[model samples]
Target: MKVLTANRLTNGEAVWLAGDHSWAVTLQAAEVALDEATEEKLARAGTAALLKNEVVDVALIDVELDSGALRPVRLRERIRAAGPTNRRDLGKQAELQIAVAA
Candidate 1:
């Protein structure tokens, strides 16, 4: 994804595109720069990431066609941000339950 993450020119916060045509403020301190076309690709990717809750770095925030609307935030800097789901963890728990049942 081509996220165009940058400090908001006005508020100095990190913002990126999210799912449902919404924007999310990231907790990172990275600047994402890109051209007009690159911004579009990033935005689209950001939207997908949000819905999936995919783990993404603030710098990796894809800036899409409407990159201008996103604002960067300070919170985007948090390390090890998990995605929307933890399949492995869930599978482990399920395995334990099955073991008990058996």
Candidate 2:
């Protein structure tokens, strides 16, 4: 599977593209693309968002269902989904179960 992701231009916060076509703050809310059509659609949306200056570093990442939850395939993506590592209280993105890759 895949998930669309980017950094919100305003705040540089990692965000996921939701099924409803909205940008979500957490990975759990991201829309998973299980097929090529959905992936293409997501890619278009990401491109539009980028052109509108809504986000940056748009990309699709590979992912898998881990214990019934979304898990990013790459270490960098895992870190992004988990939020900052320095502190647990600030900008922490809930539990790992709550939230990617293209």
Query: Which residue pairs come into collision in candidate 2?
Result: 28-99, 60-102, 61-101, 61-102, 62-101, 62-102, 72-100
TM-scores for all candidates: the values are 0.26, 0.86
Model 2, range 8-102, lDDT digits (tens) per residue?
A: 99999899999998999888899999999999999999999999999999999999999999999998998888876776544635443343111
Q: How far does residue 39 in candidate 2 sit from its true spot (Å)?
A: 0.6
The lDDT of model 1 is: 0.41
The root-mean-square deviation over C-alpha atoms between each candidate and the true structure, in angstroms, is 13.7, 5.3
In model 2, the runs with Cα more than 4 Å from the true position are 94-102
lDDT tens digits, residues 7-81, model 1?
334454445444333344542222344566656666566555555654343245432333554332322322222
Q: Name the best candidate (by lDDT).
A: 2
